[model samples]
Target: MSDKALDEEHEKYIKEHSALFANYAKAEFMIKHNYISKQDRLDMAEKQEIALNRVEKQEKRRERLMKQIIPRFVLYFAIMTLIYLFFRWLSMYT
Candidate 1:
């Protein structure tokens, strides 16, 4: 192919797939250079902060539910234990 025709073809290919080409080139460059940008570090920190907040909210909700459940459970167990002891005492007497 003539040089002019080859250049035109390459330009057309780049125009047609500009985004894909840019992404591929960026990935290749990052792999070769092993460098992370400040923006990437900031984004990672933001994501970690969001995740920590979500986990903390979940833990607070779990603790609230546990607080409600534990007393009910303890009350139920105490009543059951008292009933069992009363039954045993009556059986022994009779």
Candidate 2:
């Protein structure tokens, strides 16, 4: 085959099967390099999941606290406004 035709064939093969082969190659490289064992990777992934869940729960708690606090804040402001108006009326009479 001509060099140009061979290149075209290789490109076509990559387009068709690159994802599968790439996954295999990545796993192979990782195992061969011994940078991380499979069990260690799984443990890290599980710890990450737990950490993410804890963060999500804290966010939810903060949101709920804000929801409860906003209405109390509005009520406090309204009560203060009414007290100020009442004192102003008393001053006008004096």
Candidate 3:
């Protein structure tokens, strides 16, 4: 009930869950006050790091699939073209 007691309780809450409190505060400010804080910027940076990591993983997967597919397609096309030319020459001679 006393201001000092409330302050102590608030400090304890902050210490126990600093990251959660910081995120909640940022959300509250963005929603209610329509203002961004320093903590919000830090949170955005952290989220960007996660997003970049996800994008990097996706790109690696795309590269691996491309590596597998390109050679197979090239080989298939070359075989098909050779077969077509061989048939065309045989038909002309017959």
The C-alpha local distance difference test score for the whole of candidate 2 amounts to 0.71
Candidate 2's residue-wise lDDT over 1-94, tens digit each?
A: 4579667855755554565456546756776798778896677557656755765675687578769879989999999999999999999999
Output the lDDT of residue 23, model 3: 58
Name the weakest run of 10 consecutive residues (lDDT summed) in model 3: 12-21
RMSD of each: 22.0, 19.5, 19.4
- Candidate 1 at residue 93, lDDT? 83
Ranking 2 against 3 by TM-score, winner: 2
Point out the worst 10-residue segment of candidate 1 by lDDT. 12-21
Against the true structure, what is each candidate's TM-score? 0.45, 0.56, 0.46
Q: Mind giving the per-residue lDDT tens digits that candidate 3 earns over 1-94?
A: 4579667855755564566557556766675775777787678768756755765675687578769878999999999999999999999999
What C-alpha lDDT do the candidate models reach, one value each? 0.69, 0.71, 0.72
Ranking by lDDT: 3, 2, 1
Q: Give the C-alpha lDDT of model 1.
A: 0.69
